[model samples]
Target: MTTITRILILMLIAVVSPIGAQDFQGIATYKTHRDFDIKMDSTKMNDAMQKQMMEMMKKQFQKTYLLTFDRSSSVYKQEIELSKPQVGGGFQVSFGSSGSDVFYKNVKHKTYVDQKETMGKKFLIKDSIAPIQWQLQSDTKHIGEYICFKATYTKQVPKVNLNFNSKPNIGDENEEEKEPEMEERIITAWYTPQIPVSNGPAKYQGLPGLILEIHDGKLTVICSKIVINPEEKVGIEVPTKGKEVSQTEYDDIMENKTKEMMERYAPSRGSKDGAIQISIGG
Candidate 1:
């Protein structure tokens, strides 16, 4: 071929090659609903105290979740909040925190590095695992003006417990002996293919589309708004210095925190008079 023709072909390839890369970007939302089946061990408490404690626990706990996702290459964010607030005499307590997670996908190396932030700190965890082992059904849908795809993957996420801070002080010395609680959860996601990005709101991705919605068996998160391919660039990265622990350890930490709080605030949580002096400062 002539030198001029070869040069022209090379330029053409350079201009159009990214399209062949099949890179698209879009956004989706997920909603989750959590249900707790808590049973107290009456064997551990006096009949009266058992009833009282069970009632107290039932009253204190409501479903909650940790929402985390990646914003860009190596950057992630998370929010932990109560799915439902406890209310009974026109009062409420709020427990919610926001954080982040990291994202790194080395397509060339076929490796993924995922990181997350908790309470303003960062932790890294395994991103590559058995490929979800899920069977899903998909349908095309629209979110606002965007043509998106929706899918439902009905499967159990086995129970997951995250023990962040576990320290025990008193009450129900044998509470640790009780069978560890397991949460059975289901997740549903809605996404868009228009953006062509294989990333979703959180650790969920690699689907046929960008997730616009996520629904767990207990809670639901809907992406009320989305902006794709903005003029600005976003960067996400992996976390460092986070103590590596199993999910059980995380759950233990959480449970320990719950126990500590209950003990410290027992008077308020247990007394009817304290209940009467409640305020839900919305």
Candidate 2:
């Protein structure tokens, strides 16, 4: 063959078979840790007139979540943990995905206490559930060499409508007029696609990369390390529950019980045990 013909053939091969394809089946790792101050919204609390200076203390609440993704099969596995003190607690959930459908198993642990109240008997318990619907929210962006993406996701929490029994009642059937205190924490997550997994620790997922950090205002959960695409297939199991109840009913029960407990435990007229007490009618 002529020299020109040889050059043309080589050019044709180069054009057809591109060199160095993207690594769509490799593992990615990420880790980050930071501190945050926690407090209730001033707008939600009563007694706005008396501005109380809240102190900032170091609260140790950390978590570790492990994730494994297989891009070839589109399946992912996650293990989450909650590490905290006696007053506060943590929970864990395991989830995996096959195609568009996802499956989950959740386990949560908390300090348990039972007592009687005006509303009824109540229990303070902890539980966790997993494998909710999660989708990719955005494309990957580069933060230095590492690609990242900010994706917003949601978890449908049960309605929490708890009445405040600690407040004074005007009359019978007048409870509706009084204002109740409650708030629904709508959670959103930012993930990175560098990991290429649809699974995240707790209820966080659906970003272009691993979730380095997440906050629901009150408590913040961050990823310390993420190991992606392990060679062996990981098994995710649904955890056994110590206390089982739907998300909606659980909040409702807690609210009523807390209010009743406050009323009974707190000093009403002139006792220091209550959250607020006033000496009157002496």
Candidate 3:
């Protein structure tokens, strides 16, 4: 059948079928993966070492998240797992979002509360949800048992500079610094109307249905399983712990911290023995 015909049939079924309880709630499990390629100086690092590093990076990027939602509110959080010891080289790198952070969204109020911890400090980021202008498409696909419709949004995001070198750059002192570049990216989401809830993993929502899959840049989030109305009702609580701050304030704090780290670990001039250079592409 055509996509339009399929949608019509689903709408008919929904009209004829008996409606469930009014207090709708569900738990969705999502698996996330990012595709990245790392390049390092061949002279400093051997093929075996690079291979080991790639394996470690892969483990870091592969993570799972759980979203518990009622009718108007939802809580999305990463699944906590035991940290494994870093092997291979003596160098260890830890980056990206923390596993303990919690994201809470209230679609009815158009607000979000993100509880995050960084630099041994906890912050509760409270802010209004930035509206996304989604262009709903007629394309349809089946994700597991649910038929999903496609939606897309375009936005400009900061371009990532992944070149890292343990060698200081020697440039003219009179040269002016350039502003950070921005690039446009299209975010694609596949939502299932069967769920009939405006909830999704992370900060993405505002859809007519629950999002089953998302393609944001190089990262992909796919719902692996969903349980609707379990025996024990899930409680959605607003986080109270941490110093409250706006989303912009939290972003500024993180940016300053990152700059500090870069300055501290930046390589000195005339360094050769332990110099390491890495470039990443996605």
Poorly placed runs, candidate 1 (over 4 Å) = 1-92, 99-130, 157-170, 174-176, 180-185, 240-248, 268-282
Pick the winner on lDDT between candidates 1 and 2. Answer: 1
Top model number, TM-score: 3
For model 1, state the Cα shift of residue 144 in Å.
Answer: 2.4
lDDT of 2: 0.37
From the highest lDDT down, the ranking of the candidates is: 3, 1, 2
How close is every model to the real structure, measured as TM-score? 0.52, 0.44, 0.88
Count of residue pairs whose backbone atoms collide, per candidate:
53, 8, 0
The TM-score of predicted model 2 comes to 0.44
TM-score of 1: 0.52
Put down candidate 1 lDDT per residue, 1-282, tens digits, no spaces: 454654454355445433234332322233333344434334333456544434543443332222232322222243345445444442232332222344454322334555544434444444442344333343556677655555565554546442212333457766565555555565767665544444555456655434666676645556655545435544433455566654456555556655555676554333444221111110
The deviation in Å at residue 239 for candidate 3 is 0.9
Candidate 3: regions farther than 4 A off: 1-19, 165-177, 270-282
Please provide, for model 2 over 51-117, each residue's C-alpha lDDT reduced to its tens digit, 9 standing for 90 to 100: 2212112222222234333332222222333433333112121111111122232212211111112
